[model samples]
Target: MKVILVFLLALGINLVFAYLLALGFFYVAEYFFGVCLTVKEVFFLWVFLLVVAPLIKLKFRSEE
Candidate 1:
């Protein structure tokens, strides 16, 4: 139960942090490149991938 609770909290925090990071990056891109991104689409895909991709790659590292 404790592990599941911690996992849920971490998941929520990661999602929100990822979304905010995406928002900031897109803002910078627009400032420099003059291309605008829709927040809904940007947050939906990139944020999910950003969080999951690293987890997939680092799956075994923590065991060391």
Candidate 2:
């Protein structure tokens, strides 16, 4: 039960962090490029990074 509670907490924190990160990215992109992205786009980009980053780490690790 304790482990499950920790896992849930971690997941909630991760989601909030990802959302804020995405919002920051959205504003930065707009500031630099004048291209406005929707919340859906930002959310998808955030999730994509979360999925791809670990794969990239594994690939680099294997190459070493």
Candidate 3:
């Protein structure tokens, strides 16, 4: 039960981070290049970052 709670908490945090990142990316692209990402595109980007970000963090941590 404790493990499940922790997992859920981590998942929630990751989701929020992904969402904020997607929004930032969308705004930056729109402002700088006038490129607008569709909802589907943003969702896919968020999912990709959610999966990859943690692995990247782990890699950097291990190298330290």
Using lDDT as the measure, the top candidate is 3
User: What TM-score fits each model?
Assistant: 0.60, 0.67, 0.81
| lDDT head-to-head 2 vs 3, winner | 3
* Model 2 vs truth, CA RMSD: 4.0
In model 1, pairs of residues that clash are: none
Can you write out model 1's per-residue Cα lDDT over 1-64, one digit (the tens) per residue? 9999999887777676566667777888789889888868786766676667457546757777
Ranking by lDDT: 3, 2, 1
lDDT of 2 by residue, 1-64 (tens): 9999998986676566566667788989999989999878987988975655546557888999
Assess candidate 1 and give its lDDT.
0.72
Runs with alpha carbons beyond 4 Å of true place in candidate 1: 39-41, 48-64
Cα lDDT listed for each candidate: 0.72, 0.77, 0.86
Instruction: List clash counts for every candidate, in order.
Output: 0, 0, 0
lDDT assessment of candidate 3: 0.86
Once fitted onto the true fold, the runs of candidate 3 whose alpha carbons sit more than 4 angstroms away are 56-64
Candidate 3, which ten residues in sequence have the lowest lDDT sum? 51-60
